[model samples]
Target: MDDVKQNVQKVPKRKGLSNKGQENFWGYVFIMPNLIGFTVFTLFGIVFSLIMAFTNWNLMKGLDKVQFVGLDNFRSMIGDAYLSASLRNNLILLIVVPITLFLAAILAVVMNRNVYWKSGARALYFLPYITNTVAVSTVWQALLHQTKGPINSLIARIFNLPMKQTPGWLSSSKWVLPALIIILIWQALGYDILMYSSALQSIPADYFEAAEIDGANAIQRFFYITVPLLSPMTFLLMILGVIGSLQMWSFVQLVTKGGPGTASYTIGLYIYRSGFQTYRTGYACALSWLLCAFILVLTLIQWNGQKRFSID
Candidate 1:
């Protein structure tokens, strides 16, 4: 009887271990497809590109004729005028980020309150974010047309300005970057608002109630309680906005095509033009690696600084 009881316990122990192993096996099986795809597509491509960045591999000459050029490709970018112009344009567009965040936070706060048609308002704000970028760009292109666009028409009507004075938004070099920044802000606003709204909802209502009990006014409570707690979300959005803004190219490409004289050219467009249009594959790879480094450094800085302001 004692031997049989020990044998039974041993059997269950083995069965439990077997069952746990099976569970792990199925888990891996379920994730294998994604793991394989990520390895083959993303990881391999990144490694290959990094390698190419150090080699002079003109596509016309084929991979067999590739030569290791050390840092020659990187050195060439030191005085590249287009690169400088692109960097400057990117810096200019960075302004859109803070303005958009501020506006989105305000809208989110308003939307979170008890209001009629709140669901509809939320949907309306988020619609732009979900819309296809190409379609959005195309629509904006028509709306920003120099001759017949509604934006200029509105300006003319409101300010009683002449057609010439209304400004050529997409056509002129001076206004193209600003116009693109506006469209970008409009497109990005919806997502930021949604995020802020969610973050606001997550904050405990008792915090606000306590502030109110202390005789804090609405604006005071908002600034002290709401903004401080929302700092984490703001930090997240700031990082994302910075990264996206730095690599902004699609809207510029679709709208200005690097402008009247490369005035609105961004680093991303510069890289694309270098790689495909100009067939400077090696140089483009180097540029991409440099961009990657820049993003990484910026991200690390933000991460390190999060402790200063992040409530959580």
Candidate 2:
């Protein structure tokens, strides 16, 4: 009995997973649900949409009616006046990215200094970014009213102009895009400022100190040292900003409904209108693919340019 007991004790317990293996197993187990969800919802949706781009699969007509039309959807794009207008509007909105970047950098520099209520100021700037888009859109709509809005009212009083002389804003096609641009700039400022402020923290103080010691004024120091140091962040923000601007449709849909005769139309808004409003799901998918292609090309150009210009 003693010998048997010794043998039993000497026997290694049935080999199981090593500690690292067990940890990895549990890690994968914990992430499995999210992984599955992403595969099914995101990946599958992308594939499905790509396939649908070549078919006339209107939801109203049912999946059985999904007729493959080859490149008919794409071919139709050349004659799409609405799509052309949306593309033009999208190109125009590209200006928002640079303008927002410039303003955000300035504001970030100011916020970085020892200003009063610094934390409060940062929060105030970021508030609009986190606020509900619908609420912001609604408020802006009221504020940008042609004659009755407070903005026009203030302009009339300050400039000594009549209400009729004030810009039509959302009502007039001539001014509608500009009005949208202004609203977008205001709404975008908060996020950009937050990004710039965070990037500012990572920059070493040595550069600024050296600049000041070299007899550089505030403006010169800002232009030479601060801006150069922030180039990487600026590049990242530019890409994100451009993508966001291209994908922007919620504000257009909610505030102007791409109204004033398509002045505020965007590719994204047109896609939504095509898919849901008109049940042209196939056509919408084609347009979406086009937008995707444009973005991809633009992003590639930016990446290559950065690689060429960036320091080794």
Candidate 3:
């Protein structure tokens, strides 16, 4: 009887293993196309770039003509004054993200307060984010033109400021990054508004009702109830904002081209220049790796801070 029981258990265990294997095989088969593409495109390129970072190569030089310079590319990046300035611009991007989010949240709250045409307000806000980046940059470039732009005209009227043709926005050293920030904020405000509005919708109505019954003022409810519940969404926005800032390049490319002596330059623009403009492919790879490392470190810090704060 004991032998018979052991045999029964063995048969069932073997059948279970066979079934599990078959399921896993099907799963692998289903995802194999994606896996193969990812490995070929992303993984291979990453590995290739890693290898290239240690060498020096250009179009003029053939592949085998590459020279191994170990950490020299890294050393070059440290000493490169342009790169330092670009990093500052990148940091400015980080600053813009949260400010944009805050503005969006305020706008969203007001719009979503059951005001008429709430959907229209939402659409208007999101429109800028979905607009063509190049077109927006061009429009901004025109608006910030020194002589005839609306912004300078407004400034002249409000503050009685001496216009003095206000320097060409993208050309001016002091204002290029700031100008870019303004455009970025304008472009992204809508997306953040939509996200915060969605989050507000997801929040249960009970909290607000109870607060209303307690004779809570709008300010009190916003602080004690809305803010606490919205923390996680804000936290997510923070991370994405930082990442977007770190990867920022399009507007710079469209407007400044890292011009006026690299004032409004960023790491993404730097990498693009090294690879495409300068034809220093290997050096570009090194620059990319450094950028990747910088982003990784900063992102890790932000992520850790979020977890510690228990934003979720």
Candidate 4:
């Protein structure tokens, strides 16, 4: 009886150990796909780019035994005139991003007030955001046409203003960047408004009710109750907005092609021009790595800031 009892106790312990091992094995199996992909794709890509950034490659000659040039590419771009223009454009977009988000928040507040026609309103606002960029940009091209355009004609009607000429948006350097920003903000506003609106909805109604009873007006409730709770979303939006603005290339291309003396050029477009257009792969990669570092810093800062605020 003693021998049998000892074997029985050992059997249960052995089964428990076996079960735990199986559970861990399955967990590893499930995560293997993503782990493999990250290593193969993202990690490998970063490593390849990091290596590429140190050399000079051209389209005529491949990376065949390329000589490593340390920091020349980085040094070259630092004082480049076109780079300054692109940096200026990026800065303008960064400044405009917060303003755009604020506008979106205000729009969300008003829209969230009444849910009677919510679906229609959402579709109306989000339509531009979902629309094809090329098509919308083409439409914008027509709208901004200087001579014999609807916008000019409309201006002629309102205030009976003498419409000498509508601004040639893509054609003129002065209006190109601002025109690009206008369209970008228009496209971005709706999505951000809806994001904020959803975040607002997630906030507890009791807070609003309490504020209501305390004689706090809508604006006061908005500033105190809503904004604070929505900080996480605001932080999220700003981070993404900054990233998107920094890499803003499509609208810059469709609208201006970095023309009008490259006034509307951006880092992304600049990189593209360097690599494919100018066949400076190494220099392009250098630019890319620098921009990547900038994005990394911004993302880290936002994440750390969120942690601080939440903890505080």
For lDDT, the strongest prediction is 2
TM-score of each: 0.89, 0.91, 0.88, 0.85
Q: Write the per-residue lDDT of candidate 4 for residues 1-312, one digit (tens) a residue.
A: 999866755664444556557668779889999989999998997898788888887755866857789988889987888778887888776876887889999888888876789879888888999998898889998887766668767877885766665566667888777777788888888899989999988988898999999999989998888888889899999999999888877777787788889778898889888888888888888999888888889889889988898786
Q: Tell me which residue pairs clash in candidate 3.
A: none
What is the C-alpha lDDT profile of model 3 across 20-62, one tens digit per residue? 5766877999999999999998999899899999998775668
Taken over the whole model, the C-alpha lDDT of each candidate is 0.87, 0.90, 0.84, 0.83
lDDT value, candidate 1, whole model: 0.87
- Return whichever of 3 and 4 wins on TM-score: 3
Model 1, span 184-234: residue lDDT tens: 888999999999999999999899889899999989987898888888899
Q: Which pairs in model 2 have colliding backbones?
A: none
Candidate 3 residue 45 C-alpha distance from true site, Å:
1.2
TM-score, model 3 to reference: 0.88
Where's the lowest-lDDT run of ten residues in candidate 2? 11-20
lDDT score, candidate 4: 0.83
Error of 1 at 63 (Å): 1.4
- Residue-by-residue lDDT tens digits, candidate 2, 104-177: 99999988986899889988988888888899888988998998999999999999999999999999999988
Deviation in Å, model 2, residue 194 alpha carbon: 1.5
Per-prediction CA RMSD (Å): 3.9, 5.2, 4.7, 4.8
